[model samples]
Target: MTQPYVVRYVGGPLDGRVDSLPATPEVPRQVVTYVHLHAGPKIVHIYELSYAVEYGCEYVLRVEDE
Candidate 1:
């Protein structure tokens, strides 16, 4: 199984909050993806991720930008 990626609002009113995605083995692992924002509360301060999945190993690295 491929490890999943979770997006969390790092800063703003939603800081320290996490949104999760379901995992399905039928999902193709070799595809690029896009994220669409819903029409709701707005966000401030973009968060950057320093993580990627290559090979069979998994990693989670967090480095905040100020």
Candidate 2:
């Protein structure tokens, strides 16, 4: 089986070199795991990665209220 594609966030508040995960929109737990392993604990969102000219998203992380 192919490994799950790692989503990359671009533009917006998350410009670059800012390891700050905002507290507004809670990030998904699974995505958080990926981020914690890769980006760290300051990343909030993980959108689906796209290579085509037209953008597309398969699925996004959604954390249940705790």
Candidate 3:
């Protein structure tokens, strides 16, 4: 079985959220998609796996022009 590790989101709407996920091959980035309202267009937030700490890792939100 794979060990589960904690991932902390550093910015954007999901800031401060912590998730326990299985340890897998590290990816360069993570993507989050959400809609503001029932009729609103979907928004994509990109995050990069920035660094690691004693317990797990941190994903920092990436800012870019759409």
Superior candidate under lDDT, 2 versus 3: 3
The sequence of per-residue lDDT tens digits that candidate 2 reaches over residues 1-66 is 443433334443332322323332344333322343345556555433333333222233344469
Instruction: Supply candidate 3's per-residue lDDT for 66.
Output: 94
Q: Residues 14-56, candidate 1, lDDT per residue (tens digit)?
A: 4556555565245433322224356975433434443333322
Clashing pairs in 3: none
Instruction: Give the Å shift of residue 26 in candidate 3.
Output: 6.7
Candidate 1: worst-modelled 10 consecutive residues by lDDT:
53-62
What is candidate 1's CA lDDT for residue 17?
A: 64
Candidate 2 regions exceeding 4 Å error are 16-66
Model 3, 1-66: lDDT tens digits are: 778777788788778888876675566345544334446676777777766665467777888879
Question: How many clashes in each candidate?
Answer: 0, 0, 0
> lDDT, candidate 1, residue 37?
56
What ranges in model 1 sit over 4 Å off?
Answer: 23-66
